[model samples]
Target: MISTRIWNALPGPALVRLLILLIVVAAVVLVLFEYVFPWISEYLALQETTVEET
Candidate 1:
């Protein structure tokens, strides 16, 4: 029953290509949020703040 059903299912190469694309996109997004964006934000905030008499 299972083998017959799989014979009628979608192709394997398409599924593999889709999974690889998803993995690459996820890795790039994670690196952007985890390392690049936070460092940029911290640098900008430090530049904005000043020691003033109040």
Candidate 2:
């Protein structure tokens, strides 16, 4: 697949490549949690409703 080809094209030893991949994955996760999650939460927030009786 394209990803496998790209992975094979990366430079350095297997360990170095693995470390780089891990760092990239971590960065993506951190960005999503820190930025994307909060932005999505703002739009998805639940509102409380009040009912009145006469």
Best by lDDT: 2
Tens-place lDDT digits, model 1, residues 1-54 = 985564446346767756766777899999999999988997676657678998
lDDT of 2 at 13: 90
lDDT of 2 at 8: 92
lDDT (C-alpha, whole model) for all candidates: 0.75, 0.86
Per-candidate clash tally: 0, 0
Q: Candidate 2, TM-score vs. the true structure?
A: 0.73
TM-score of 1: 0.56
Runs of candidate 1 with Cα error greater than 4 angstroms are 1-12, 46-54
Rate residue 39 of model 2 by lDDT. Answer: 89
The digit string of per-residue lDDT tens for model 2 on 1-54 reads 997986798789999888888898999999999999888878874555567998
Q: Which one is best on TM-score?
A: 2
